[model samples]
Target: MSEVIWWKRGVIYQIYPRSYQDSNGDGIGDLNGIASRLDYLAGLGVDAIWISPFYPSPMADFGYDISDYCDVDPIFGTLQDFDRLVERAHGLGLKVILDFVPNHSSDQHPWFRESRSSRSNPKRDWYIWRDPAPDGGLPNNWVSNFGGSAWEFDASTGQYYYHAFLKEQPDLNWRNPEVREAMHEALRFWMRYGVDGFRVDVMWHLMKDEAFRDDPPNPGYREGWPDVQRVLQVNSADRPEVHEVVRGLRRVLDEFPDRVLIGEIYLPIERLVTYYGEDLSGAHLPFNFQLINAQWNAPTLASLIAEYEAALPPGGWPNWVLGNHDQKRIAARVGEEQARVAGMLLLTLRGTPTMYYGDELGIGAVTIPPDAVQDPWEKNEPGLGFNRDPQRTPMQWCPGEQAGFSSTKPWLPLSDHFREANVETLSKDPRSILSLYRALIAFRVQRPALRLGDLRLLPCGERVLAYERRLGDDRITVALNLSSEGQVVELSSRESHRVILSTYLDRQTEVATATVTLRPNEGIIIAA
Candidate 1:
């Protein structure tokens, strides 16, 4: 509404392909399956969609380890099916953003294969390859984020290759001009196909310290990794040269009008802001992940809200994410009753918001059986227990068998609670979280303040969290009772605000002494 791109001001729905909708009865969702659901997505008021990877892979990391950068996997669909999906999404007024995994590739990828061949091969230097230490140990003390050593021995080359994640996902050597150019060509292929943009995976790891120094010791331990120690010097995949690579990518995006580039950086706000590039044109939004890590409380939430607003680079866009394919769903994290409060916070924030699919239906994590778990992190990190299978289960659409997700059995079991949380069940209930999410999305669409506004935090009072979003002549203030009890916050004398939206079970019209009372875990948006 504030002269921003439509994709920037509206919500982005993230669909995990393997679990979203399966059409071929193969128990796994594909491109055609997602194309068939365009009407449902349109009805949900989403402006765009960001689908997870559907590229060819060995399914080692559930498609994150891409074997071919330009081709869709047989499990997902053909490239023609993908083009049809892109065409259909655009026809329905939905922009499509693809997941670009430039950090690493499946070990089976041709580039990796060539890189791992004889050291004399022209592509041998395309990936990060190094000699073992004098003691035949890993090149350094670096550990993979997934766990264990990041280096793997290549018997053919007699050298070790770096893989920041699973061994199958070998890290690319961006330091190689040829490698960077090849990846750039991959971008050209997608952009030429009319894809709107990309959600860069582990983008920070594009560049690494070339010297391969030993990682410093951890300051403290949680389960196994450090809590306060900075992994930048040793393990920070985001090297200084990453900016040059980003500039190259940004230039590619600049070639197309209205294209976007978002990066997933799991770092703190300070380090995250650097991804914006000093030229004010790098990653359009380095996802704000503080809320994902912050404790669910009034003080912590208030503090983080202020920190993120101030920490973002000047003129750079901000985006909020409550849940993703890799993390626990909000309902499972904060309880179903409080999930609406989290939704209100997300939708009412002053920037773009990305919604994980099934979140609008208040879906919770499935109780995964031990045999059905497929997350490599859980399999490798035994005692740490970092399983993400429950969060990536199939979307529940109805009360029928397989929850109407697929005619056949699904890759992961749907929760029994799907009988109550399915879209069909929530569509008929006006008081459901699904309804509340729609109302807020519509409310955001009609408001300029919530889209591109400057934020002002109101004074903290009586278990309430309040803030004002202002854009030009438009202004809206939001208040939330993050606690389990009611809270009363006084409003300005001349400010008679109308309740534009609320996530409470029912609306309360009573106002006592210019103070509005909020029910347990309630949130409201007021426009003056």
Candidate 2:
């Protein structure tokens, strides 16, 4: 058998730097701030940290619209601070993963600046620029993931450039070998600084159809859905040629040992698994976000997990994420009680699990005041409920002023319940959600069955989701009560079982009967 990889067995904690901590009192978290909290993360039992984009940007889409790929944003500190952060994280035996946004460059980027300068400029081909349609409208029917047309007209150059997201973020022309080389070099630049890996942003949008064909209108489009979803992005994203770009990225990471490449793909399980590429040469893990959007019910989740497990490529590894910067918090989506069950579910899953920074503390969405609205998505498509500001709020560290996230106010508002739901206060509580997360992560680390075992979905009722993870004699069963009521899951085996951990953090080593009686909104891990 091949040697197990850290990214495969260990948990990854995602820290949105803008909200994690603020060391310089600038109301923004920085690399130095993250470095200071390494001990907290280490104690949380997560194996790695995936920091969101902190590279130089004009803040168009926050840091996602990167202007300089090789350096840190001044607001987040300098390249030296990043190096020290990696060093500190390594000292704590923690791996570091950075978010790589390659699909687009900020309109303020020098490359895009030159590209939009003149039609005959040397860098004009670096971006996806095209002549206007005969109707003098959009180059194609492509819609921006943010809203409206994906093409931004550059009157100075007399052409339109494509942007999968905001118009300020112009898509890079990956078909150009020069652009590919430059982006690959950017990866190497960070790898040399001891960065462990990257979670590639918009991995499927790297390559668009060469012919710039119009995307087909979605037959299932609803009246209130986001404008981007009104049309199927058939020509604008997930193109077959994107695999070649992924393989090239894999080659770049393969030049170094044990470096992981995770693709931020929002496709279906079948299409998402294809990102592993032919012969497993593509991304190491195409992020499985099914749980993020899936209905919070046993039947739906059970089928989703089973289908995802069955869809993995030969050596493809699986990963799970319940919440992130872009979506509603798990706690908000499933309520505070179910979030603990969700934590247990995430950590005990067969493959890697990524814990969103504040989710461990049961931090849900914050009410973003209209005067403080910051997310470009919410601004671009107003009143459509596209606001992500609630989920991207400052991390709740303590009950002190500003929730101990910063000396002053944070870039975004803090949650209303931050005083009660914070790491400082909850860490001392034996039954707190933070305690549950720490216990779950530690439990997963100590159990081989939970770490690298093959999963077998067990028979269970509609309100319960049960699965067994086994590697030889080492076997563990995880059953979660997905609803708000009590659930009893029958066991197939007559062998005695011991309760290893529970979401409430109250039970341990208790022998189980023929059936496991789960409290409302609870999850348990049993050892047989």
Candidate 3:
């Protein structure tokens, strides 16, 4: 057997807990609901699930504003319910990875409360607090990711508390050793509960510039973009100290067996790989969101894959994510038919693929009304059209009431295509996107060429992307047509090839000749 780690050879499924499935008619998904869906996830052949935050929170930024890192939110479940979730998920052979938000904690958290209580408090330095600038304005030009200034002035404390996100979520002082130890203890707490790993939220934003330097303007920023793009976050994000932080986190995670540390970073590929740290001591996989932001064209995606593959440090594993809770749905970003092609590219590429929950069904973003906007960013800037609620609706389990996600109305409205775009409805159709995903995942898992292989992008022209994944004697060739118009590519290989899986699920013709024909928006994996 190969010495590749399980995470290196497996795919991870992201489950946004609040919208995954609601069991108790509370209009919100809880731990029991997630537990109930274990078999469904297992049947999909995913090796692990990275659940978004379900910790006790004030819901200022939904679950991202964590009030208690150790306990489960009452709306989600209790500590016992979380225990049951981990146990059940592990029993089903699915590793459970929790979302670890070490960057910031809710202002309601006991640590922040004590830190902000009085300047003389024992934990006063646990969170970042600074005095006003010379003009008595704000500290500096640091921008909050949500919008507006990064500092929130506290009248009682006579200093400004920093928050990279919403004001309710204060930035934790990673510079302090005591704060680092406390956060490390949180990791230990979850590890003791049998959790497999963590997907650290905003891993690049852990350490900010100590001098509080003003962020410079983005020269390339265009009109009609989100306001947060107005300034380049030079001093606010992706500081060099974060790798040291990652090393410490890796040390804590090293105590466990077969565990993984995945970081959520949106940096350039060159800077992103450094999180792997010297000697691979940082994150095992700093999520590559390049696939998410890349244009849906062969040339664009081909260059992105090549650049990312070249950027990885020696012994550093690669991972891919097409969509996540914070971004637009892949189906909506690309078209519905092309989502399958995107899925193929995500899985067939030489990396561990993290599939967002509802993408397997080609689910599009639901329309969110002005009054029902849930994202704090949307509320902060209503004119920017940056609301994330449309992509966070409840999971469509069946065709029944509330799409069988809940007995009562769900917290968010169900998608309009819930009837046809559900697990039950698609389970019966062999050509459905869910079926395609199952087939692709099963095939990808069983093939060493797909799992533990070297990636080599072939020169197949601009409209077609062809790559080979070769492992010793085993080899798999993949061809993806980026356009709606049918195209053809010539493979250099003279050996015969058989179709393993196709995006359209009908192209099974063997490709023994140099020229290979393709259907519009088709993606196929061929056994070489």
lDDT of each: 0.85, 0.92, 0.90
Kindly report which residue pairs in candidate 2 clash with one another.
Answer: none
As for model 2, its CA RMSD to the true structure in angstroms is 1.2
| Best of the candidates, lDDT | 2
User: How far off is residue 353 in model 2, in Å?
Assistant: 0.5
Give the 10-residue window scoring lowest on summed lDDT in candidate 1. 226-235
Clashing pairs in 3: none
- Writing each residue's lDDT as its tens digit, candidate 1 over 1-528 gives 547787679899999999989999999999999999999999889998999999999989989999999999999999999999999999999999999999999999998887777898899888888899999888887777787788899887789998888999999888898988888889889989989999999888898887888777755544554222324344446678898898888888888988889999888888898998986768887877887878988788888888888887778788899999988999989888789999999998878999999899898867888888788888887545468987898888888889889999898888879899998899899989999988888878788788778888888564778889999999877888888988887775555667766786456343334677777888988766
TM-scores of the candidates are 0.96, 0.99, 0.98
| N/CA/C clash count, model 3 | 0
Q: Please, what are the lDDT tens digits per residue for candidate 2 over residues 1-528?
A: 136889988999999999999999989999999999999999988889999999999998889999999998999999999999999999999999999999998999999999888888999999999999999987889998988988888888789989899999999999999999999999999999999999999999999999989999999999889999989998999999999999999999999999999999999898999999999999998999999999999999999999998999888888999889999999999998999989889988889998898998898868999999999999998898989999889888899999988998788989889999998899889989888888888888787888899999987889999999998888988999998899888877788889989888877988876888999999999987
- What tens-digit string does per-residue lDDT give for candidate 3 at 1-528? 347777999899999999998989989998899999999999999999999999989999888989888989999888899899888888988899999999999999999999989999999999999999879989988888888888999999899999999999999999999999999999999999998999999999999998888889999888878767889887888898888999999999999998899999989999999999999999999999998888888888899899999999998889999999888999999899889999998898888899999999889978887767778898888877788887788999998999999999888888999999999999999999999999999988788888889999998888898899999999888999988989887766676777767888876665556677788889888875
TM-score, predicted candidate 2 vs. hidden true structure:
0.99
